[model samples]
Target: MLGAVGGGALLYLSFPPRTLWWLVFPAFALLGIVLHGRRARAGFGYGFLFGLGFLLPLLAWTGTFVGSLPWVVLSAFEAMFIGAAGAGIAVVSRMPAAPVWAAAVWIAGEALRGRVPFGGLPWGRVGFGQPDGPLLPLAAIGGEPLLSFAAVLAGLAVGDLVRRLVLRQGPRLLVAPALVAVLAMAAGPLAALVPATPNGGEDRTVTIAAVQGNVPRLGLDFNAQRRAVLDNHVRATEQLAADAAAGRVPRPDLVIWPENSSDIDPLRNPDAAAQIDRAARAVGVPVLVGTVLRNPDGRTTSNSSLVWEGGTGVVERNDKRRVQPFGEYMPWREFFRLFSSYVDRAGYFVPGQGAGAVDMAGVRVGIAICWEVAFDDLVADSVAAGAEVLAVPSNNATFGLSEMTYQQLAMSRIRAVEHDRPVIVATTSGVSATITRDGAVTASTRQFTPDVLVDRTELRHTTTLATRWRSAPEWVLVALGVLAVGAGIVTRRRAVRRAGRDEDG
Candidate 1:
């Protein structure tokens, strides 16, 4: 039991705002120690403990302002997915090539976790932690699912190797673990062979700027000062324009703003529109303005990114399709309102419809506003629709100095590599950064500070294998895991029947 909890802690440590990614090996190794040879029920108990140990701390930021209930409830829910994986691992622990089956089972759990109970929260995925690890290259070949599988597979294989050696199991048993360990290590070098044009080599390069016009205050109340927030962005863009005029920096072809940079329904509010229009004209380029649009029904709002050009004003728009469940809008509002007064504070926002990409300055830019980047499909679909570069416009001011921003930045970095496209992350409060196609952070800004990051961004029309395959890798891994579990169940039943016959005889 201690091992299970400790293992979970180790896995959590591997995530960013810290770079102890290698800890993932020992973490899952410890989990293997607790789960191996256990019954499904026992495995579930241990897995639940592991989940609590891991997710409680990882998701602590969720409740920073809203209080502990939502955070605890969300973490508890996500942990159950890990617990399910543990049960599956236990069932297949004694099977041939157990490490393979165990890793596949883990992926199956993640796939399920990313899809259910409100389109799922795909944050805290193991692959998101590997932006600084050696296995990062694998993302180019197979995306996050494959990267996660490799991490678990290597760890479990190590655990299996250790167990066999300690038990002095015959040399024959060592072959499977040793072979798997070797293959897993080889995957890194093999993945590196995949082509990555980090600097857009020979491709069209555009000057892109990410503006972080910080909020006047932190917490949920920050959006209340909508005018102040809008002015801050306007002031920052005017500053960028001045810089360009003074030859301090290159003028950007397109500028990106963080989500909720304008919460004041700019389309409906004439004053807000004027402010945004002023910023766009000053920059002399199309500005991707993140704003809220009130629906005609007056009950729901749309979180959208509208392309604002100097003369044209509003050109193209992409409404956020994957809205944050509780924060953006409440589910079973009346039922949840009974638990917390904050329930009503949740917006009545509806999901927007689009390809998740929009034209900005003759370039098709992919937009994954805030939490949308956490999901695989949202970003991929945008790239598939013809986005040459990716942008993540996020508002992390609500979390305030939490690791959430850093963790999210890590996801963008992984996406950069996964799709082989340059990624620009613009946040309302800070930690804004530009990532190259190889997952390297070229430039960044500090949190809670108003700043701007101007960089030469490469636009690539070519897609990586991961982008082309989309969710295929995840589904394939899940299918194999299900098959492995079935085989294990059949094997166990046959053994039980043979034992009963012998006893009767």
Candidate 2:
């Protein structure tokens, strides 16, 4: 128990702290090896504890933003997947040639974990922590799961070797790295494969700016201060314009503001329209502004974005799809509110229709507003519908200074690679970023600050194989994993039948 706890704590130190993410695998695998020697049920218990230990803190960010009740419930729920992975590992380890089956088991666990409990909170899936690690390149070919597999396999191989060295004792210790080397080389192929991502400070670039108009207050009631928020963005854009003219920074092609930058209902309020016009005209080129729009009926609100065509008020526009579950709108509000305070306070933002992509000069901009980024299908839909460059207008100010912003940034990074497009992420409060096609963060702002980070890059018009295939590779991997397990079950059944016949004879 102490060893497991210590190992789990070590795993906590492995990520965001530095490039030590690889340390987590050996810890998990060693915990597996130690527990595998116990009874099946006991083995599951140990694995679950280790999983709980790891996930409880890793996903603390979830509850950290929402509150303790939410944190406790979410951690317990996320920990179940870790427990499930551990249980799967225990079953696969009982078989002969356990290591190969062990890898398969982990993959199966990842797949299962990603789909359960409201489409599963698929955060911290092992592969994400490898953003700066050598394993990052693997995401292009196999997506996240393959990178996860390699990370786990490397650690498992090390743990398995260490166990053998400690208990069995032999020159066999030397052979483990060679086996892993062959596996890693075959998986990544340093010589033959193209790196999925590119190094920063490259040749081509774009001077794009992200504007953060930090809202004065935090709740939905603060929407009454809509003019103030709009002015904040306008003032920030003016600063950028001055910087550009002074030659401190290159002129930005487009200036992006966060969702809900104009909460005064742009269509209904003429004053709001003029405020946006002022900002776009001040910035010069085009400004993508997130605003609240009401249809002529005025029954509900549309969380929509409009493009400022130079001096013209609103040109191209996009209504946000995938309205947030409890944030933008509520689901089963009366029933859900009994459990928490926030359930009752959610927004009334109505979902919009259409692909939500529009033109800015010649760039095909893919827009996923706030909550929409969490859903991969939305991004895939945007790409299919014709969006060469991606722009995310998110308002993270409500969540305060938390990992939610970083997590959202990570999600945007994956979308960039998944679709082979340059992603410009603009957030209110902080962490606005410019992502290249390769999933690199070229520039970003400090949290809760009014600052602009600028980057220039080639806007890729081409789509990636991942975008064309979408989630097909993951489906293929899952199918193959199922077949492998099914084949093992059949082989075991045949052996049992043969033994029964000999006994009868």
Candidate 3:
């Protein structure tokens, strides 16, 4: 029981806002030890405890203003997925090539968790925690699923090696587990050998300006100061234009504002549209303005990124398709409201349909609008549809000084490597970054600061293996897990029946 909780905590430490990426191996090693040779029920219990220990702290930001109810409920619900994975791990732990099977089962759980219960909140995925790890290169091979599988495979191998040592196993018995452990650890470096096209082989390069116009104040009240937020972004963009004129910074080919930078319905409000137009003319380039547009229904809203050119005003737009549930729109609203008034605070956001890409000055920029980056398909599809670069415009003001911003930054880094495109993360409360195609943060701003980052990034049309394969690797891992679990169950049943026959004789 202590092992499970401790392991989960270690796993939490492995993520961003901390650099203990290597700790994930021991974290999973402990988990493997606890679940090995245990009954399915026992495994589930330990896994739940592990989940609480890990997610409660990691997701504490979710309750920074709304209070503990939502955070606790979310953590507990996500833990159920881990608990299910635990039971599968226990079933397959005693089989041959157990580490491989166990790793596959873990990914199968992640795959399922990412798809259900209102498009599934995949916030704490294991691969997201590996942005700073050696295994990060594996993301290019098979995306997050393969990276996660490699992490678990290495950890489980360590657990098996330790188990063999304790039993005083002979050299022959020890050789296989020891070899697997070494090979698993080496997978990262070996994957690093895969030649990445430098500068995406120079398809094109463009200077981008990511503007971070901070909110008036932290918490849910920022919406009330919507006009102030819009002014802040305009002020920052105009500052960038002045800097460019003075030869202090390079003039950007295109600019991006964080999500909710203009919460006011710029489409309906002439004043809001005028404010955005002023900034676009000042910068002398198109501005990707993240704003909320009221739908014709008068009740629904579209969280969209509109392309505002100097003279054209709003020329193109990409609406966020993965509108977050419970945050963007409440699910079972009346029922959830019975528990807390905060449920009503959720937005009535509607999902949009498109490739999630828009053309700006001949550059095709993929839009992952905040939470959309956490998913695999959304980002992949954008690149597959010919996005030359990616932008993740997010609003982290409500969370306020929490690790949430940094966590999201890590996801952006991973996505950069996965799709082999530079990722520009522009956030309202800061930690905005420019990640190279290699997943390195070349430039970043501090939290709660109004700043502008101007960097030249490669616009690559070439897609990585992760982009081409999509979810095929994940499904293959899931199939392997199912087959392994089935084999384990059958083997156990045969052993039981033979023992009963012996008793009868």
Taking the candidates one at a time, how many backbone clashes does each contain?
A: 0, 7, 0
Rank all candidate structures by their TM-score, best first, as comma-separated numbers.
3, 1, 2
lDDT of 3 by residue, 22-134 (tens): 88888888898899998788888888888887899999999999999989999999999999888888989889888899999999888888888999878898999988888
lDDT for model 2, please.
0.70
Measured over all alpha carbons after superposition, the RMSD of each candidate to the real structure, in angstroms, is 1.7, 4.3, 1.4
Give the Cα error of residue 375 in candidate 2, in Å. 3.8
Give the alpha carbon lDDT tens digit for every residue of 33-149 in model 1.
788988888988899899998999999999999999989998988999999999999989999888899999999999999999899878888999999999998998889999999
lDDT per model, in order? Answer: 0.91, 0.70, 0.91
Positional deviation of 8 in candidate 3, in angstroms? 0.6
List TM-scores for all candidates, in order.
0.98, 0.84, 0.98
lDDT of 2 by residue, 1-505 (tens): 6655555656655655255766766675666566554544665566667766676676566554457786667666666666655655555554554555556566776677766644445666666666656666566666666666777767666666666666766776547544873475356444125533332323334556788777776534545677888888888888888889899988988777888888877777888778778777777978888988876666667888888865677888899976765567777889878888877667777878889688876566789998677565678888778776788998877766566677678767767765677888888776788888777888888876777767786864564555666666667656655555565556656877999999999
Error of 3 at 240 (Å): 0.4
